[model samples]
Target: MNIRKKVIFSFVILVAFIISISSLSMITTYHMKENSSFAKQVSRLINIQEDMNELINLVTIENSLEKLKNIKEKFISFENDFELLREDITKKDHKDLIDYILPNIRQNQNISKSLNNLFENEHAIELIFDDIYKFQNKHIYHNDLFSKIYPEENEKRKLLQELIFKTTNLKLIQEFGNLRYYSKETLYQHRDMETFQKWTNSIDEIILELRKNDRLKILPLFTGYKETVEIMGNLAINIHNIEKEEKILTTKLIKILKENRDESSSIEIKIEEVAEQFLSKISFIELILVITIILITIALTLYISSKLTSIIQKLNSGVKRLKDGDYSSTIVIKEDKEFSEIATTFNNMAQNIEEHQNTLEEKIKLRTNELQGALVNIQKQKDILENLSNKLAKYLSPQLFESIFSGKQDVQIESKRKYLTVFFSDIKGFTDITDSVETETLTEILNEYLDIMSTVAIKHGGTIDKYIGDSIMVFFGDPLSNGKAQDAISCMNMAIQMKEEMSKLRIKWQKDGISKPFHIRMGINSGYCTVGNFGSKNRLDYTIIGGVVNLASRLESNARPDQILISSETYTLIKDTIKCTKKEELQIKGIAHPIQTYEVISSGNNSTIIEEQTGFNLILDLNQIDKNNIINILKNTIIDVEKNI
Candidate 1:
């Protein structure tokens, strides 16, 4: 278990132990008090039974009313005490004792009162006879004195009669609920009442006989006194009979008292034993509580502390491992309390972190591999594109190619009017020469001728637009431009170089055994023309088109072999840097009027010259050809030309 649960469980165990101890102690103590009270009551009841009996016996023997009066008070008090105690008793242990004893105490509560009644009867009988005895013993016998003293005796006897009536009446009420009266009718056939009737009849006969003996003057005072003495005697006998009946019942009462006493003693002993056992048990329980508390405290403390320390250490270790980047670390907990929950959460968190890290690492590795593959593929594609671009450069002008690839020009159907110098050149009678030669020889010668012309065109900063068969068109201006006049001059210079290169080719072709030589015609024009990509979206040609371009083609078509033609507009632009001669105003189809034209002769500074005679041409570039071989080559060229003719 975790620390919190261990502590709480320990506390609960301690509390339960404590409560058990307290509950047991309280129960034992309660029983002990009950048993203690029971024992005391048993002893007290025995004492009351003994003391009240002895006091009643003593009062009966003394026969003194004062003493009996005191005894009566005690009897009432003790009897009331017994009654209350009997009512208060609820224990089953003394059930027989209380049952036997309590009834006896109630039944005999009148014992002292019975004795007092006996004494009162005796006193009444004595008073009844006292006046007769005094009257008989009278010393002065004078008639007046005798009358006076005897009358006083009669008065005394009358008072004694009243005492008898009151005692007998009280006895009657005690026995039969108030039946005594001044009548001859007997309400009961009781023995004492019968004896009282007998005495009453005997005294009445003596009193009647004494009336004959009137000489007994005291007899006159004996009126109603006989009945008084008889009633007093009967009361005494009744009291004695009641005492005898009480005495007669006492043997059984004494036996019951003895049995009850034995029963009480047994109960008291049981109470004492129970109280002692409870007391000893309470002590034992206290000892057990202390020892159990100590054991539990030690056990729980060790268990909780060990568990707490170990779990904390494990948690701390986990934290340390995680902090050090050991994401694979985990913990094992067997307890299923709060700490187990925490450990589960922590384990889940750690597992998630580890899984996340693993997943992230795997993703990074996969992406890295993909990127490497992509780079390799991209490099391969780049190599293919570069090769394609190199091959494509041969078809497009370098200026247009560079501009488009360099992001300087947008490849779209767009054009602008730029004043450009345009040039067109073609072989003279190229079809007739082709029909005379073999196809392979013609092909080699045409390629050789076009290669020479293209080299000259590029070297002069002209963009080679396209070539149709043996014809070539070139232009200067955008995508790059110097000036309109400079463009025109550059074109003229390029044409002149072409003528010189042709002269050299003619000599080389003759040496290769060609029976015919090729001559080229060139045309130049300068004007505004639309120049840009011209075609559909999928395919485009970076070239020029307009009247200027058409005019250049026209000029080339009209020129003679080995001749250069120039429009007036182009001649004006190149006049300062080139040598041209006016030819004629040739009528062009698309023009409203005829246009002026010229023949290009040479550069303002001529670097070379090539001349045509009747059957041969002479070519020389003193600045280009080796000085030592020039004369021999010229004399050799003259012989070869004449031989060919």
Candidate 2:
């Protein structure tokens, strides 16, 4: 696991150890309290039983009422002590202990009370019996004396003895409820009352037998003897009831003690089990804690020591190797830690030093080789430069080549919107001419024609843009220009000169075994166009683009062979310097409006079209035609036409 989980696990184990110890302690404490409580309650019960036994002894021995009262008071004290202890008992180790013990305590108290009542009833019976016995003895003594004085009274004395014998035998009657009450069986209904009434009738019968017509009936003590017997019968009934109640209470007390013993025994067993479990848990916790501490100590020590020592040793070895000039040696310590970073840095340092050494060696060798190769490379470059120079001169005008090579033109990729006179021309019917001419003758004628046109274009400072098969695209007013008027004039001059040159080339081609005539169409438009080195960085073309270029191409496409068409914009710029004829407005694609164009009839004092068509004989200042119409034109025209016609 990761460090976080390991730490949490360690913390959990420690907490569990503490909890185990605490739980053992709590278990021990609870049992201790429970044992103390059970012992106290049992002791109270034993003490109560002992006190009750003492009270029973007193009833059987001294039978003193005061002694009985004191013994009963001691039992009450036991009950009070039990109550107080019950209050003190808070921990319920055996949750049902009170439920099990309380009724028993109550029963024991009832038994004590029953025993006390039994003693009282038995004592009263004894007193009554004693009085009856004493009265019987005195009557016997008087009977014996009277029997000696009159032998005939002996029958009455014998009857008296028999009656006394029967009355005394009443004590031998066993109670019916005694066996039933102890066994929790139902008692005969009203058994005590029945026994009481039967006992009272027996005493009445004995007294009646003594009172039958006899000479001894006149004795004054005989009435007291009868009253004593009646009292003794009542006392006997009370004694029997009390004895029956005592037996029941004794049974309940025994049952209570038995149940108390069982419950206490159960609680003791449970406490023993808890103690055993606590001990086992404590032992296990101790074992785990010991093992965990030992393992963790060893593990942490090894981890920290091995990590720190191994990484440091690797680093030290790397440093020693570096000192020994083994700069190429690398330190590799594989671990998921910061040591990996240190090793990486060490490796990089070693690599840098090694690279520095290798670089120094390489630089020395390169310097030597460069010196040796310089002469041969110089001669080789001279030949290559001469060939490139010839090729560049063939493709570019001297002015364009100078501008670029001298750094006057940077040749960066950029475009500018400028009003430039764009020129386009193509040889008409060159494909058919090529079809009719031999390849060698065709090449000679094409080259001768291009060379002538290029010379004329360069003379007028026109930039030769490119050649498309038999077509030529050139532009002026860039790289060098006097003004718009001058640039337009130069472009028109170039077009006219190229047309004149093509006329001579056509005648020359025919003379040199050529069959067909070659003609050229030229189109020129002056407007805003974007001009720049337009292409990828590796290969660029100094070119122009925009609607103006397209319009120029369209003008070229529309021009008849041997005709040079120019837009109105160019026409206006060089109208005074070059002559032109206004043609129909031509519709060109990509242009919103029709273009006003003119045919270049001639250039520079070549054209003359100043005659007016209207009939007139007035002295007209025709220079005003180049300016505006004179006001006398209408009157002169009417009279002169009428006279001259």
List clash counts for every candidate, in order. Answer: 0, 0
Query: Please, what are the lDDT tens digits per residue for candidate 2 over residues 113-229?
Result: 433443343334334333333333343443344334333222433444454443344432122123113212112244354544553454344445445534243334334443443
lDDT tens string, model 1, 550-627? 999999888998899999899888887788889988888897888898998989668686776546657766668887
Give the top-scoring candidate (lDDT): 1
Estimate the lDDT of model 2: 0.64
Pairs of residues at least 3 apart in sequence or in different chains that clash in candidate 1: none
- TM-score for all models, in order of appearance: 0.45, 0.36
Task: Indicate which candidate wins on TM-score.
Answer: 1
Backbone clashes in model 1: 0
- In order, candidate lDDTs are 0.69, 0.64
Q: Which stretches of candidate 2 lie over 4 Å from their true place?
A: 1-383, 606-645
